[model samples]
Target: MRIDAAIDAFVRQLTVDRGLSEQTARAYRGDLVDLAAFAEEAGVTEAEAIDLELLRDWQWHVSDRLAKSSLARRTAAVRGFTAWLARTGAAAGDAGARLRAPKSDKHLPRVLDRSQLDVLFARLEGRAAGDDPVAIRDLAIVELLYASAIRVSELVGLELGDVDRTRLMVRVLGKGGKERVVPFGVPAARALDRYLGAGRPALLRDGIDALLLDTLFLGARGAPLTARTVYQLVASLLADLPGSGPAGPHTFRHTAATHLLDGGADLRAVQELLGHASLATTQIYTHVSAERLKAAYATAHPRA
Candidate 1:
């Protein structure tokens, strides 16, 4: 069998039997695709034919140029692939058993300050109130993203029936098909109300009740907004703002979570709101909150 086809089957097994997240499965497939391409060029076809020296050399070639995190993730893919080969009796032993990922740099997430958020929100409101339905839809998209701290996929996948405005909560289908209810503040609710009432109707070319119809923010053709479009919106907003960091839809989530913690929201509460399966995932915002507090104290307090 071709290595690409074999790697595809292996990744499918990881998804169905091992219950890995789709993102993880996709990453594994990407790493293995690169490996398969290289092996095919070198005339190595079978998993058993992959020796430690070849594995080491491939990793060395990749590590020399790729970022440490990228190299680390690719290394993990190698280890996982080799382990799978051994488990399935395709190989005598794990060829990459001793392979190591490079240490990754722990860069803090970029966050917009409260004032910046205020400015962005103001701009969003103005845009939404304009004579365009797309702008109105974009208002709701921005509001929900910042308000919920959900992944972009989750946000775009949202349907009208999924939101329970009566309870001020949204039912989200998170990673692993896990369902969770995430709450947002009143402001988000208002923006959503505006979109549903006024904006969405203007964009309806078909009978769809999706809360964010066609896409929350539609293009000139009146189709739903793509994740890339949402990312560009966030990036554009960050560019207008003063501080510099990795700006994307995710940055809004990090900022929202950190700000909630800074305002003394309980850690567990933040965890649930973010739909994190582990408290550890939510705890990163706690560190962000603490860092902000330290910075504030250093600037404001003179008691040193």
Candidate 2:
């Protein structure tokens, strides 16, 4: 089979059978497409022609151009593709079974301190106090993001029915199509109430369709909110802050999880709250909490 055709089949199986998210499947496809181009350059366009040597050569060619984490992801992508091809009888053997990439460097995710969070919320609240619908919506977006610790994709994917205002709970469809309920604080509930009651109505255009009406958050043009817009909203909000890492919505997620741990929330409970598939994925916050504690001890300790 052709490498491109094999990659398409593999991605389809990933999404349809394995239940991977569209974003993940797209990443797999992109990595495989790059591999296919490389294979073509080496006169090995057929899936059956792939070999360990060819895979290693391709990795060497791209090693200097890509970051370690991206290289790791590409290696995993190709390994999955080759394994699938072998299992489906499209290839002679799994060419990437022995392929390896360097482990990605682990940097603790950027987390905001309580004072920083307070300043951020105060700014948002000041803007929301005015009658501007977009400002109100922005306030609600940041509030719910920090309160619920949801992925930006999950946040924007929410529908109107997904939230239970009375209970202060939200139902989110997480990675691998898993659905979980997450609770938010009263502050988030109040912000959501304001957005739903006033902000959303003002943003909705006349003669809107039913699908958009069901969407929980709307853009300035009354369309469903997108992940890019959410990122921009968060980036602009965090630009003037004193921190030194990414200023996207995931920073809110990391901050929320770290704060939860710092306040003595159970590890397993936080895992479920964040809709993590594994407890190991949630343990990173514990490291963040410990680092914060060490920092506090170093600054306040009087003894040498």
- Estimate the Cα RMSD of every predicted model relative to the unseen true structure: 2.7, 1.0
lDDT of 1 at 193: 88
lDDT of 2 by residue, 25-57 (tens): 999999999999999999998999999999999
Best by lDDT: 2
lDDT, candidate 1, 1-304, per-residue tens: 4566668879999899878767779989999988877776678888788878778878887777899989988888888888888888787888889888779987777888989989998988887777687787787888889888888878876777788899989888787777888888799899888878887777776755455453444544556657788888888877878876778899888998988888888999988888788999888887777777888899999983
TM-score of each: 0.90, 0.98
What RMSD does model 2 have?
1.0
- After aligning candidate 2 to the native by TM-score, how far in Å is the CA of 21 from where it should be? 2.1
Evaluated against the true structure, the overall lDDT of model 1 is 0.81
Best by TM-score: 2
- Clash pairs for candidate 2: none
